[model samples]
Target: MADTPQNQAALALQMYLDTSASPLGSALQRAPMMNIGIDEGELATLPLVSEALTGSQRLRATHAQDLALTVDVEPDPARHALVWQMQMAQTGEQPGPRVHNFRPLHIALDGSLAPDLVIHTWRGGAQQSFFPPDAITPERHVLYPRTTAFYQDGTFTIGTHGGRSSDQYMPYMLITTADDSGGLWVALGWSGNWQARFVKPRGTSDLHLTIQIEPCDLRLPSGTTLQGPAMALGLYEGDAAVGYNALRSWLRSHMPALPSSDLSHFNTWTAMDANVDETRLLDAVEQVAGNGLHYFMLDAGWYPSPPNDFYSGVGNWRVDETKFPRGLEVVAERVRQRGMEMGLWFEPERAYHTTELATQHPEWLLRVPGREHALVNFALPDVRAYFRTFIADLVQRLGLRWLKWDFNIDPLPYWQQANDGGLAHLGHINGLWETFDWLRSTFPELTIENCASGGNRLDWALFSRAHVNFANDQYTNPDCIRRILGRMGTFLPTERLNMIYGPFQRREYDDAAWQVLEGSSFGVSEPIDNWTGQFRTSLRHHLALHRATDAYRSGHFYQLTPDTDDLCAWEGWQLHDPETGSGVLALWRSASPEEQVSLHVREIDETRSYRITDLYHQSGSQTVRGQQLIHGLTVGLARDAATLWTYHLVDGEENQ
Candidate 1:
């Protein structure tokens, strides 16, 4: 069989493991795919000792000093893309030399692939769009929500500042040719601080790309091996959206599957605040009973809170007797009786300075100067064991089916303060993975929601353990929600992307409904008692719409409008299921003055005809040829309005 572009890319990656010749010399001098800094120096300076191919998809190479690197290449022929993962380990009997700044991906592209490349990246923190114009200085250019730079560059770098992987920037990038024809999509799967550097030296066409987990300086114990975080490289042809879809497809196939009942939920934190009581919660549960919400999450305040304060009760894991005299089991039973699962929130990694846990186990705490709360050192086996028992007990006692794991404090200071040559961070992160793995294996039916100050710790490493990610905490602003959904959807599977809706202060019903459609799963934080009859009707209607379009949420997504943060622009995307020839187009007319916009749908069969239905309005349906639909479709909406239009093949052609 002829080698496709994807297979060709895989073969090119195989060259990095060739041992007969120097892997980093002459022919590959511009492309050192992996780098390691040890006590002696960079690993590239060492001679290659041996090379072996385990199978058609796996390659391994051992260099001097028993340092081995492995690459796993999986090709998706349907998408015409190659997904490759890299990991390094120490293979000697004795402990290896102290490793420093281990980088899993270190490639330097020169000649034709360097000069005209365009780099794309996204920011990952909350309220990124709320910054003022004056706040965005040239020095803080990388701090913005998103950036696209045409490279004639000296050097460019994007990375997280704190311990959480996605605290400052997302661990994903897309680099394409100037004309948007072919390039590489890179994603780092580390759940800790990660960095990516693109360096193009002066007067040279070489563009060096490197990704590493920062502060990764540690030595392996005897008979123990240290592995770097996984790095995935996806090669794509054609436009940027093609690259985005390819990466998303790869992630969906690799990551863990989400729970069957996690699609839509209701959170009580925003609604009831810290004053949650058994009576109020039971009433809240009744309000959502058969309202299309699958889970009822009692966040934060359900635990013991001193002075009725949520922040002060970080380590108090038991139910607050004063608020829930009958215990959480009562409410949990009610939720289950109503055909809904119950979820509880817990911040297991932090303890308030005044809490009993912190007072008793000060040695287990990772402290920084002047912080109100101390980070629980998961690196300690005792700590992990305690939490595993504590959490499991509560899950069984309360009949809880889901856990919303929240981490609010930043652990970078403590990790750096430990001064154990970065071993503290490494141990703590690995311990977290172990704990999560234990939970999944112990309770196969349980669902876990990975949240860290809302979306700060999201990455493939964490995604592999948890079911879904909460995008961000800024849910009140429709514009912010829209921007976050679009950016996160670029590389993440839409089905694993979750967001919160309301405490609806001043937002309109239309705006709230639009936000709900943008994500696959959502939780409402508003008090049900405050909902008017009309509001309740509208909420139910929207929830039904969301459930009806489940296929679209998991389908191939394409951004139809310019990726921008401007409030006055029209933004939209299309989700197509190629197998069934069904899809939905969702558009938001933000605050734009224009009422009508033209959208050109992609990946449609030009020879077929489609039945299009307008979901928001009672305008019935229309039949249109695929060629005409792909050419253009004019949609009109008033300012601050949004619409959902779904389409599928006509005349029994959908099966094709």
Candidate 2:
């Protein structure tokens, strides 16, 4: 009813590309124009998951008989959900990964003309199957030009001669089948976080149809989540059941709406510290405006003509009458009269040659055309419409909500002045995704917090709109923030406890309160530039335990094995609440020189009864419980130390 079969694969792709020698619309005129010899520059989109298209012919074996598997399973009564699938044969092709003998397509909810796809059909080395075998008979294993979409209704297209724009690190695709009994053979490979590999059909050649898309925010009728830019399915081969059923119906119709959780505030740049002065920056902005801080940032030599050549700072954004001669509206009106909120720091698409808009226009950046020294190409669309009209005229003349947007270079030799024989990188990564949709539709309330030369484009399409990320240069290097927050919290959420570095350390740093009490206490980097008083009482005791945890900056956990938890580093959080300590137990210090670390604390639920303290060493009450203080806990460290323990359940003994 919702216009089925992707409206007949978008009305059979306007009747098979209307008529351009429809052999898959001449697969872009018998492919090959990715020009191998190389001449012009800038040419992006590259993925077939590497090894140069895994021995070509789309990973060999395209049927002579035998090996046909398709699956589907259903049961989702208004959210009791269950829709599995594995389909791949039936000539809508794409053979590998879809081994025969299927059955699992179960359907219900009445009006059933069938819809339950959860396939997983394997063959040889001990066969397997279970697709459309039950639920009042359903045998759907359909997939062909049957509606293919990477992003629809708005627009999306990718197929640039086998993808892998930068390092082919298992950008996903591993379906195998070879000891032949005939048809079906998909080796084209790559996957990791666990690990996988394939791509071995023979010699390898170009086969890109890659459409690595990601857009699912769906926060309605319950929930769903997926994010941006980690894409790369760019290539088709060995019968891919109509491109994996048109990429699972373009990710079940490109979901959106569900992105909110940053809990901002992570200061820096009140004159990129040359060792803070001006009476230690007016005493660290009156103790970061009485700790209600959201942002007081000013960073990078308060402009006025400093960008000697970052593509030469476009029409220079003012305020450098020689380092703030009472400008930047008097330090943004004394940071809005210290109620807190000022953030600054800009890049306006690089223009440094000691700036003056790069000693005068320099023909608005992005070079390689004639080459007067290159690199500075936001894939040029008039240099991203002159940085979206100079950041919509500097956030409407510096009222500035918040923008620390930094890119720090890396995108070379891409001239693009309406390119042609210029060697395109898919329109320069679609002009870097249209300079991030011109900075979120032109400053959609500025909160762009991103930096490149630090975390190297920290994947998932720049967290779908820079949802506050800096996390690299590891704020003081907490061993690279405990392995990138334990592998990006298995699909981000717990409000992405956004990270940034710097904290009470001096001299290059390694222990700023043991790297901000070991990674992510959301937005806290200390360099109190010289405001001693034990650096304002350790940023007021880490902003009083970051204003009493909002579930350690947005809840969700389970990592009780960091080389066996030292000094209490356990995990737990997923409460709806009704009793028993609602969650949180960071307790810092996993040892460095402070007594060569050794304190393993494992899953402490050991039959309830908890009460730990040390909210920076207690002030009231004999809070001890947890079987009388975790077996008489005697954990302490002082050479650049850090502590945090706030447990409460004063009485507990019920899990019956």
Tens-digit per-residue lDDT, 504-614, candidate 2:
446333323433433343565566545456655555566556566545433333332342323333221111112334444443444444443333333344455655555
Query: What are the per-residue Cα lDDT tens digits for candidate 1 across 40-96?
Result: 776555433222334336555454566665556554455444445555566787666
TM-score of 1: 0.87
Off by over 4 Å in 1: 1-12, 15-32, 41-96, 128-153, 222-225, 651-656
The RMSD (Cα, Å) of candidate 1 is 5.8
**Whole-model Cα lDDT of every candidate shown, in order:** 0.72, 0.37
Model 2 error, position 150 (Å): 21
Work out the TM-score per prediction. Answer: 0.87, 0.31
The count of residue-pair clashes in candidate 2 stands at: 75
Clashes of each: 0, 75
Q: Which 10 consecutive positions of candidate 1 have the poorest summed lDDT?
A: 135-144
